[model samples]
Target: EKHLVLLRDGRTLIGFLRSIDQFANLVLHQTVERIHVGKKYGDIPRGIFVVRGENVVLLGEIDLEKESDTPLQQVSIEEILEEQRVEQQAKQESEKLKVQALKERGLSVPRADTLDEY
Candidate 1:
């Protein structure tokens, strides 16, 4: 059976009803978030309290959606080779920029003295 708890603040939490006492108190876990309480019930108190099943709005069983199990397309070898080539070109350009920046700072490397050798 579903469990329900009424906060003195007029909010209700719905879950698998666990247990209740003669004092109209309740204990429940796996609770859903709060629902509005009617002003007719007066202001809810600050402490936890049990709500009667008859008083509950009875939002039916929760439904969770399942994920699709479709497989992703396999990458081709040509695509992988092209990606590697692009990465290597980027690295070479970055090294060239670094050498140019060092030269501007008066920190020349002898090995990088000739653009043709680079």
Candidate 2:
């Protein structure tokens, strides 16, 4: 991903680099203080030179990983059938529970009623 680093001194550096030499290495641009770079999860410790690319101002950043096309996995006929059976079983169990709850509440559950009526 391309990222832009805006330094404390108000200068910005735009680049398409992964990381700096080291986690402690600071990058210096024109009129900008040494900008930190690299794997920082939270507030970067002072004197540690590792600024996350996302923390800086970026005009544009494209995810190269998302650009690659990959074929989706195919489901077998048996697997589809199994999934449908499980879904049907769950629906039946849910209806049973709903009926039981209505009985407990002293409410009459209508036979052959749609789910919306419940």
Candidate 3:
């Protein structure tokens, strides 16, 4: 069965469902992560996976018809990865400024997860 899996850390995997246990642990065959950035996306081949249940945020059957209707443009993996890196860097710079401004005003700002942790 074709399946789409979302990871807690914001990654998406599309593959064939191979097996699952009572705990929701899964084995996926011919897996690849579909990464979306803005109106574009790319697929990074990942092969087989034994996904731990805790890491899965969502799982659903892929609707072939609906999937084909998506408006997002597909790009080469290399290009998309580069775009993602640039986007992340920009976010980090913005966050740094926000954190610094908060500190200057004697405001304590809670730190979010690391910029690259996901």
lDDT of 1 by residue, 1-118 (tens): 5544555544556566566566544555555543222211111222433465455444343332321232433244455445546667998999899989999999977664455843
Can you give the TM-score per candidate against the true fold?
0.31, 0.33, 0.91
Worst lDDT 10-window in candidate 2: 36-45
Ranking by lDDT: 3, 1, 2
Could you tell me the C-alpha RMSD of candidate 3 in Å? 3.4
- Looking at model 2, how many pairs of residues clash? 3
* TM-score of candidate 1 to 2 decimals: 0.31
How do the residues 1-118 of candidate 2 rate in per-residue lDDT, one tens digit apiece?
Answer: 4444564444445444444553323342221122222211111113213555344443334366753342433344455446556667999999999999999999977777556654
Q: Model 2: what TM-score?
A: 0.33
Worst 10-residue lDDT window, candidate 1: 35-44
What are the runs in model 1 whose C-alpha is more than 4 Å off?
1-74, 110-118
- Estimate the Cα RMSD of every predicted model relative to the unseen true structure: 24.3, 20.1, 3.4
- The C-alpha lDDT values of all candidates are 0.51, 0.46, 0.93
lDDT of 2 at 46: 30
lDDT of 3: 0.93
Runs in model 2 lying further than 4 Å from the true structure: 1-73, 113-118
